[model samples]
Target chain A: MQNEKMMLEIQQKVELIERAAQAGTGIVEIGSFVHPKAVPQMADTDEVARRIKRYPGVEYRVLVVNKKGLERAGAAGIMKAKLTVSASNSHSLSNLKRTPEEVIKGFGECADYAVAHGIELSGAISTAFGCPFEGMVPLEQVMKVVSCFREMGVKELSLSDTTGMANPRQVYDYCLGVREQFPDVTWNLHFHNTRGMGLANVLAGMMAGIKRYDASFAGLGGCPYAPGATGNIATEDLVHMCHEMGIETGCDLDQSIAIGRDVQKLIGDDRGSFILKAGKCSDVVCS
Target chain B: MQNEKMMLEIQQKVELIERAAQAGTGIVEIGSFVHPKAVPQMADTDEVARRIKRYPGVEYRVLVVNKKGLERAGAAGIMKAKLTVSASNSHSLSNLKRTPEEVIKGFGECADYAVAHGIELSGAISTAFGCPFEGMVPLEQVMKVVSCFREMGVKELSLSDTTGMANPRQVYDYCLGVREQFPDVTWNLHFHNTRGMGLANVLAGMMAGIKRYDASFAGLGGCPYAPGATGNIATEDLVHMCHEMGIETGCDLDQSIAIGRDVQKLIGDDRGSFILKAGKCSDVVCS
Candidate 1:
């Protein structure tokens, strides 16, 4: 029964990837290459990666926790990977069983492997906004990890509001600071809607000239450390906001809403999205 | 029994007004001075206004739908009133039994009353952003109403997203246009959370240099015409966001939260606010 469930999950993930590609998603984070014993949800990530058909011009990325995880990703044929370390020391200790400094050293080795194997690596600083155990994350702590990525020649860098404790002003100020410090790096924002400021933070980031953002279908992902928190910002909601703002995200809003419905059915819940409940602004005609 | 319930409601509204004043709210819309037969929800406006103790320096404004409503407000000793009419012709006819043109002509008499009685009068353009009956509301239509108010010497003006169909870009552009046209007016923004863009629209308005906003306590108010729509943005949530952004809304956050809790208890539901569920971002400590 367990084997059957794993296979089914893998197949479902592959279908999700295909749907995501069809919806014009340029990049998709398939799964984390963490220890299966620790994160059982991602146990079939390797099989999913091996079995999934890749769309042309679309990049598939997996999360690498350490050098061992990077090696596993390499073995599983993941040409692109997201290398992340928690900016909060408490989060690092709890989630990775290592100090933030220790994770940075391990990331050095992982970055070296990426360079050696010609793998595209994007460095992400988790808990960049706040931490459940650490309260407000100072910019210096986040920049420490950012500087490491900068030193590693990581051109693509992401800042994750891991617990979604970000406000618009904070996002605007942080994005401005990052742009000033690392003008050459491509900045990506990863937000969760745990506190319901996800889309607002995205708007702030856009005002600060950030065009790339990370969202999940049906807002399906959540932090294991933060209980009662909602998942990532719904991709359909993000796309809806963008389309309404006249910003062409190249994603079909109708198609995205359909996928959100499918994901809601697959998960057997519809509590994740606002656009799914309130349709598009243009959907209701005043007859 | 109906009279007893009306008295109870009047008492509750009076208490709510006092609490809002204590929460550092400078302006509170007390009630609408409409005909009791038309809007029974506001039937006891005269009694509520008479019984409620006025907070020093806090302006208690009532809405006046017509010249008769203005006279009733004057009789009730309401020193401040919001004179408003629907921007959409269909909404105007349905809600007020008048065309948009007739409402504007009647507002001329209401404005004259304010000037004669030395009462502070602000004008609100209802459905300035979008109308459910008219779909996308043209800016020209809104400006026509604005022009009428401008001609009537109404300097304190507000634009209301009555159906909550506004996007950030649209808000920014419209506000810029309004500011350019009515450079000297004190502009206020009223947003609804019906589509979950309320806070985002507030941010946009703030970026456009708008300092005044309208939020209902516990998000208690909704458009009578738009069924299934959420209420106005919660006061505590608005205060929480402003405080987080370093903007002084003069509201006590903890006090506001307590009031929100009281309101939740009073209303017997907790579906109105995000802050009521998540608490403030600074509520958690890193220890």
Candidate 2:
């Protein structure tokens, strides 16, 4: 009953994706192709991928843990897949049942499968900044993961602060160091608002010249391993900040806020979305 | 009955202030010396000031709106006070029943009273970043307030984002501009987390060479005029970020978090305090 109630149907997932695309989101991580028993909420990912009315100029991607997940994503007609490995061994073992090194070693098969299936592969290093069980993930571990991704022919990569352990200084220094070390690769940042430093870290990344970021609608999604942690930074909050700072994000602020509100209603709880609660700055009237 | 319940008696206020001092807070704004009818919550500020066990080296200050408020603070034996004026005319009119210019112009009497009473006075420009009633406050208006504060012999000033409407770029530029324009004045930053940009704005301010900031314990305190706005950035969250980034704030993280949790319980609600919800990064153990 819990699973049934918590899960979204394939049609609902597809509709949400379409809505996001219509709201001018350039890229959408549709769902994860994990074991149905492991993540029953995403059990209908394949069906959702097949049903989505794909919008032109919008890139649709799915999370694929291994070669099998990639095959499933390919079978569902998804063109882009992101393979992830935790930078810390404890988190990797706890979440994926493999060490970081072991996970990267196994990604060779996934890379070959993606190439054969004509899938565009991107990489994500979970807990790149820090891990829930392992306090601070060292820069060396993140560099090793980046090296492995580069060796696997992944040109686009993201460093994810899985439990929001990243601070602005660490983000700025790390982004600058990584960019200098790997100039050819495109780096993206993913941050959680667990410690209220998500937007601050994003500002740091921007200062270091990192252009891409990963944020969640309605600030949905949290790490199961990180107890009492909040979700990712809200997409509307990021977009709102970007627009306010004279940085154009190409996303409609009102529509994004609407989507966040709808998602909040569906979840039946308050997500960490500030814009949804306070309305946009522009919405405030001049007295 | 409502006022009695909401108002913290002199003894309780003293206890809270002493607790904050024992927790290693270097500066504490004990209470505002506003009229009892106007702000019943702070009606006992004078009594609290007289009763508290003052900590040596820890500066105790109270909020004073005018010369009468300053006189009351002086009579209560408080040695430091903060005088606030909104940078936006709309916010100034709504909160103080005077325009920004009028409020600043009236501060001459406050300055005279502080000098006669031998009290140190600091100035704060509310809505310096953006006004809730008037979307964006111009830098010229903020500069004008700064000039007035300087004229009134207030060498220390803070730029407060009263409604959390500030973006990082705006914050950085404004901080840089104000510091350049008035190098002799000691500038501080204050932010609200209403739109989730409080810490981000703080980060920008720090990047632009700001060393002092004002944050609320348990993130308590909101603007009555700014609809749906949350409170100031949590003090614990700021200290946590500073510690993680290797910046010395001289504030104990664990103690601050404990105070935040206590305040949360006292208020009978969940405050916008990140560190209170999630333990410090050091508290996370490696598995």
Strongest candidate by TM-score: 2
- The positional error of residue B232 in candidate 2, measured at the CA in angstroms, is 0.7
lDDT of 2 by residue, A1-287 (tens): 11224666677778789999998898899999988888778888898898899899999999988899999998999999999899989888888788989999999999899888899999999889988787888888899999999999999999999888999999998999899999999999999998899999999999999999998889987777655556899999999999999988878888899888888887788878999888888886555
Runs of candidate 2 exceeding 4 Å displacement: A1-5, B1-5
lDDT of 2 at B26: 81
| C-alpha RMSD for every candidate | 3.1, 2.1
TM-score of 2: 0.97
TM-score of predicted chain A against the true chain A, for each candidate = 0.94, 0.97
RMSD of 1: 3.1
Candidate 1 scores an iRMS of: 1.9
Q: Write the per-residue lDDT of candidate 2 for residues B1-287, one digit (tens) a residue.
A: 11224555667678778988988788899988988777778878888888999888899998888888998998999889999999988888888899978888788888888888899999989889888787888899899889989888898999988888888999999999999999998988999998999999999999899999998878887777666566899999999999999999988888888878877777777778888877787776545
Tell me the chain A TM-score of model 2: 0.97
| lDDT of model 2, residue B142 | 91
Candidates' C-alpha lDDT: 0.81, 0.87
Query: Which 10-residue window of candidate 2 chain B scores lowest in summed lDDT?
Result: B1-10
Candidate 1 lDDT over residue span A1-287, tens digit each: 11112233778888888888888988888887888876787878888889888888888899877778788788888899998888999988887789888888877788889889888889888889888787878888888888888888889999998877888999999999989988999999999876657878999999899999998877777677654445788899889889888999978888888888887777776555878887777775456
